[model samples]
Target: MTKPAEAQALPDPSGGDHKGHRERLRRRFRDAPGALPDYELLEMLLGIAIPQRDVKPLAKALIRRFGSFADVVTAEVEDLRAVDGIGDVAATALKVVREAAIRLARAPILNTVVISNWDTLLDYCRTAMATLPMEQFRLLFLDRKNALIADEVQQTGTVDHTPLYPREVVRRALALHASAVIMVHNHPSGDPKPSKADIDMTRVVRDALAAVDIQLYDHVVVGRKGHASFKAMGLL
Candidate 1:
């Protein structure tokens, strides 16, 4: 057995508290000469929520599980929960960060000239809708010369389908007095390839729009893999 004097020689558990431990790491990150790497940044962010623990292991676990920072942010809630330390709070926090980034990207498109700012429109669409687990069909209404009038979600449906009504589309376009419109939807399977139904539906919308002298500018399909543009693909 150990001696009575040796029993009191154990290291004190409260020698350094949470704040001191975290401050040390923060100082290390701040003092690094060059820019901190992506993983290091992630570590800092994770530290905000999970204070008291060494976040490097958790950070590595997340990167390993999701493959990349974007993948981690875009991961489904269930997928994020599968990680050891990731709880509902952490997952939601990460999702909010992703959404904030998307909102920032979309700010330039909100009131700008839609024709010249097509890139921003694409960025907003990809960020807002592409990461969804189900399909959502949306419309971007524009007036003459392609100035955006409204952005609306027309329908939400299963992974493979949505109920799109050309009459409703026309009615909304007329209400907004939009001269042209762009159609957008997501493919949950991450394949943006247009199906036969997609092609047929576009034709129906085009014909319907013609009745009221509105134009179908293009159809854009967003997916996790990439995006497909009907105009670029010669399908418009």
Candidate 2:
């Protein structure tokens, strides 16, 4: 009697059969989550989206293409699909995970005094904006107690610059009944240092807000390198 076709197949170079390997990965994740490196963690994630196949090579390809686990998830879907085994389903899975993480980070700061939870707010900002491909100007509107009232992306621009209208910012603040606001934008160039243009635009917004008696709390610039706070640097 001939052996079953699956039994005749050669072992996967990564290890045993695909199903067995996937179970081992899950067991490792459940037993000691931190033990798995980026590639292994990503391997497991990809398995969920592409069952019936060994995903180790695909996972490593993603890491090599994007440089890290975070970068892979934050990558544009079309870019993700360009990888060898990543399809619409796999790319969407990665994006879903990224969105879940951003929402998790953002939950703590909603309706809370943001300055009191400063670190969490920074974390939320980085998760939302750090990996974006272009510049995005965002506003955090605050009530009298400094509790966050709204978070809005005011404009999105090219890889290097965003045109921000000070009058429009103030108009939105007044309409929202916001007592104060935090300005935020990202640098795709990975340096959070404020450009001369960034500083001048910030000053223009500050003055416009002042006319409406709405305080400008800070202007934070975020990037892959880190974040810079205008208030902390005495630029505000």
Candidate 3:
């Protein structure tokens, strides 16, 4: 007697398959490197952490929770874990991406004259501080040749404000023998518009640095979307 042939089940064409979806995304990225939407880029990243799993929903959920793909990368570890399906390894992977980006942005500024590299300076600043949950006031001290001397975070405060002292800012510059200084701070509210306090603080810091004969080059306010430069606005 001839054995009956076992019936083969076909994949449902209307339903999506993880392998096919991921391969399609990978092929799309390879074909046009810059064309994938932010969610797809994030999906590819998540796929690395989650093996053989459908990561598209997790990727979209992360973006929806954090408000953007960049925010998802830059989110705090606990915050990342709070999202469903994101475990320790996945959260750490996202943080690794954030650090890599910041390091890449910072590479050009090292041992280089910063005044001539304004764009790179801004890029580094944005990568480091733009997505922070709270306010941070950081200082960039420069040498006589305008090379970066040191970068320091002087204060961290609430979402709306960071405490800063002009005397301390100059004192550190003098201690570092920095000839010029650039002040940088981030607003958690995603608006780089400087408040009145920002203007007054810049003036005070400028005067204090002047007393020490150190130049105050600019005060920059950074936010998630953009940055504001005091010198560019004629406020310096």
Candidate 4:
């Protein structure tokens, strides 16, 4: 019974049609999955975390600010919040995605034969540490069955160096009854090539573990761009 002018004054119920837009994007993803550009991928994810908002611009802004999709998700929550539109929910969602990815990468290798499952191990190392701003040395302890018992980050240091203790490394393996170990460290410089110190330290750790009859399977150096293997390079 409202007049035409009164009807015009009432707000539109349909609003901006962002719901339909979101649905279209989701359909496109379901049909062609991974076909979207990285920005679109982030946009779709952000839409879920922040309903009713136009998230495309924010997604593009995040990628532009952080340099890539991986970097954006892996960014610290506080830093992500500093961006103009990202709030607690958005920041936590991105971080949850990154952590879930890291855990998924680890799943295929945990308690499995690391020697044969080498690729998954590298994936985990890359996910967990390759992009780190500093050096962190981690160890994968394996039992006689070649199943992983523990993964531990033993040291973290400046951009170029991480102090290692050969005796301590062996002692921990012995305590854990681990029969073998794989050492991993990241080069924030993005080159996986080992230094003279890296080679010397690997040898020292190998010899020390050999005394306890524990195997030094490998020392892996991961960088932002690639990874190196001591075994493949004949250094182990």
| Top of the candidates by TM-score | 2
Write down the TM-score for model 2: 0.89
Itemize residue pairs with steric clashes in candidate 4: none
- Pairs of colliding residues, candidate 3: none
What is the lDDT for 100 in model 4? 94
- Per-candidate local distance difference test: 0.81, 0.90, 0.87, 0.87
Off by over 4 Å in 3: 1-17
Best of the candidates, lDDT:
2
For 66-135, candidate 3 gives per-residue lDDT tens digits of: 8887888877788887776787777878899998998899899988999999999998999999998889
Candidate 4 segments exceeding 4 Å error: 1-15
Clashes of each: 0, 0, 0, 0
The C-alpha RMSD of each candidate to the native structure, in angstroms, is 8.1, 6.0, 8.8, 7.9
The 10-residue segment of model 1 with minimum total lDDT is: 1-10
lDDT score for candidate 2 against the true structure: 0.90
Per residue, candidate 2 scores C-alpha lDDT tens digits across 125-144 of 99999988879999999999
lDDT of 3: 0.87
Which candidate would rank higher by TM-score, 1 or 3? 3
How big is the RMSD of model 4?
7.9
Candidate 2 at 196: error in angstroms?
0.7
Say which prediction, candidate 1 or candidate 3, comes out ahead on lDDT: 3
Model 2 segments more than 4 A misplaced: 1-16
lDDT of 1 at 151: 87
